[model samples]
Target: MAKLISLFFGNAFILAYALDESTNQVEAINLKDISLPITLDSLQTKETIYPIPAMICFDDRIFYGQEVRTHKKFFSPHTFLYMKQYIAKNQHLPRIIGDQEISNFQAAEILMISIIHRIEEIYGAENISMYVFPVPPKGFEIFAQWIEKFCFRIGLVSFKIVDGGVCSLLAYGLGHELGTNFMYINFGPMCLDLYILKVEESSNEPRLRSVLLGGLNKNYGSIDIHKSLRDELIDYNITVRKAAEIVHHLINNQTFEEEINGQQLHFSRTQLHELLNRKGYGQELKNILADLIDLASGIGVTYESVQYVLCAGSSLQVPYYRNILKDFFGYKLLYNKAHNCPAARWSGIPSASGQWQYHQGQLRAPQPDSKGRRL
Candidate 1:
């Protein structure tokens, strides 16, 4: 029998886990423990190399997540493929990486290949039975078909694409009994997604369905705040990492003081809040949440009707956003207390893990029918 693996393609990170049938343990693969950065002049480079690091090198040009602190040029650490504006669109816009003009499809394909190479190293190409991935509700079929084609090309035994919202609910259900209706908030660097989910029972098996979805506002996320802070402190030569640290501190209501190039820089919660307010971030968040609430109400899912509000993504850790959610949902908000569980941190993990459990007969959800309906 072959082993099962789950690969979660998150906005900021790519996480993978392997399931051991004998021990019934899910082992997480350290995605950061990737091999040296591969310098490829073209995306078509077919050398069977190890997984590339977070930083990719196009020809002689290199981008770094850690080096952003000292590097003069501002470089985004995230991949273009996961960006919200590109995820749902079929446009093949060209991005300038060094001197190379790489299309969106080429960059995404290269990234996908790197992810597959990493998985292949740990479990071996032939040892894997199936690979499961989860995609967002919007553009579900298109994204699922795109990922399925990639998996098929690798000659995997099988491949499955599950609904991202359902996966999140299942992951939460693994630790707690879920209510009949719940809301899932995925506030990440790329975008903020609000999902209203319903849990139904058929033939003693639980079936998960997305009742309604709203709030795919790409402009509103922690990344925007980070960029704002970086621009605000551009005169002081602040690095991206330092700006992010300051944002984290301010969000947690901690004062941050640092000296750079003989200049002292200080940031307070009040000051940061004022800055964000000036930039209309606070209002933008409120508007997005309000729109989502209105959309839910249209489908007859009122605030009081929601049983639980499950939160995911790193952006929700910010007090500004968390407070907004708390004020809106009150006591219905649920925070993942599994500090040690990777699923708690990444939005895609629970979905992938939930699918893994279903494959192992651990989760009691009925399989989807030909029309992708659970009956």
Candidate 2:
């Protein structure tokens, strides 16, 4: 059988892995610290070139310092947009931005080719057959067929689009008892992903599996704070980069000082907190959490029966969300701070050991790293 590949296309970033069909294990090539140059021509080209560690996008874009600086020098000041909300518009939908009309299909196709270029550098050109990926939630599949067709158009044959069950389970190393119910929230810069799952025993194997009861992704992420802070400093001509740096400093429990346009602004943690309060970040958190609680309630996962809440991904590394998870979920919360899982670790919710949702003709969710691998 051709090897399977695993990919996680979260709002903030893209991660891909090669699956060992024999051992069912995959290792990630270290790519986080490395940065590749961005080009207008590469977006439309697909022929051979030197391999590099980089990625494309689906809808939203996130740029590290490297690309931002490069874009400012070579392209327009608005060459790229980062930490933006996920727009669920259909393919071919007319959208106007910066006097340019670009359809959703064109953007996604560009992202696909760019992603394929990255994958080529990782696993060679033709080593993959099957794929395992995660989608946001209920409405994700509305245009999922386009993704499958895109894969084929790019020469990939088979694919699977599952929910966020496996990533959450392995991320926190939670218990997978049949009755154990857990809530997973992946807080991005511009979006939040919530999943409530119940562990169920697999009919094909002796391992446990998590089944999604309800899932939701909404526009409540760290960018919301950046937006709020921008409003508070509307008088200052602060760029998004400058404002984001200030927010980062505050999140790290340090005073923030930045020169916006010509005026210098400074604030301490206490002041940052007051600003957050003034802009109702706490209230927004309450609203988002309340909605998640309602999702849990809809799925019959009461506070009493719910085993724990797990915050997956890198957002909790920030101070505000770290506090939010603790304040809201309290002692029952676990957070995934490690980008790489340990070598000896295995999934608390095992999927590869069993026949995946294979019987129902459903795509199998991506499993965890059986060995330590970094994105």
Candidate 3:
């Protein structure tokens, strides 16, 4: 039997998951480590090339993740291509890649094609029957259309685009429990999306109705937090790359003490918390939750009505955001112990729902409200 593949295109990473026939278990793959080569005639130079640590080369032209960061000449143009705002505003921007100037949309298309090809290589193309993409709630229609077009271009005939919030609920096996309201929050690297959904029995099958959908400002995300931290260290002549490392350490509750440009620097969890507060990261989350609560209240869904708050994405791993969520939801927040990274929990959706076969065609497209927000 052909397998079903589910993909979640995140701002900073692409996650692909499918059921393994041999083991009868779900396998999740992160596509970031896989690099596609850009063939260029200039790469065939006579100069001897030295191998860099943690670098993989293809056709002696393109390099892998770490190498691209190390080599100033090589660039990764599709770093945050999946970001909604980035795609909307800069889709036409030209990205120079090895003497080729590719538009942002073209780059995105190439990246998608590469992802599909990689998936096919892992699980033979002939053995995959369908592709399912779970899109964010706020811009579901636009994201669906864009992703559907790419699917068509890639010649995928059987595919589905479902609400990401609903998928998260199903991933947790909450789809069949009727009359319960669930809040799904995805704290991605680039942005945060929250959705309130009520499970109902529709014609003997579970149905998820959208109660409220909202997101933080597009500029509010873990990456933005990293940028803020980086800016704070700019006076010390800290490079962007080093700042990212420092931020990572701080987020993981590890103290970072280093000397840059002969100046000593130290970062601790307490310092990180203070920085987050000063930058209004916690306040922004609180404000968005308040707004979402107000909207949900208008629809008869109160804070007390929400049973479980399912949190996903790597950002939620950060203590600052996790603490904010804990303060807001308290005991209602749910975490997966089996999978430390909540975002990876999404990969289990396909396997959990048995490939979403029974629930096919039941998910309703979100309708826009007076302010054009999905409700």
Residue 368 in candidate 1 has what lDDT? Answer: 64
Candidate 3 per-residue lDDT, tens place, 1-375, comes to: 456676765533455777554454566665544444433234432221211211211111122222123322223333322122223443323434345443434556656677788888877888875577766665655666676666667666566666666666666767555577787777655555567776443332113434333333333566677667878777887666676677777765669898878888877878878987998888888988888788778777788877988887656667787788888889988755212322233323321122233222253343433444332
Error of 3 at 261 (Å): 5.1
- TM-score, every prediction: 0.62, 0.60, 0.62
For all predictions, the C-alpha RMSD in Å is 8.8, 9.4, 10.5
Better of 1 and 2 by TM-score: 1
TM-score of 2: 0.60
Give the local distance difference test score of model 3: 0.57
Which regions in candidate 2 have their CA more than 4 angstroms from the true location?
1-7, 10-107, 118-132, 137-149, 156-163, 204-209, 258-264, 338-375
Please, what are the lDDT tens digits per residue for candidate 1 over residues 140-222? 55666566555546544255566665666656663234346677777655456677776443232224434334433343567
Residues 167-272 of candidate 2: C-alpha lDDT, one tens digit per residue: 5565565443446787777766556777787756544442444577887766665665666677778889666666677787786667877676788887777776
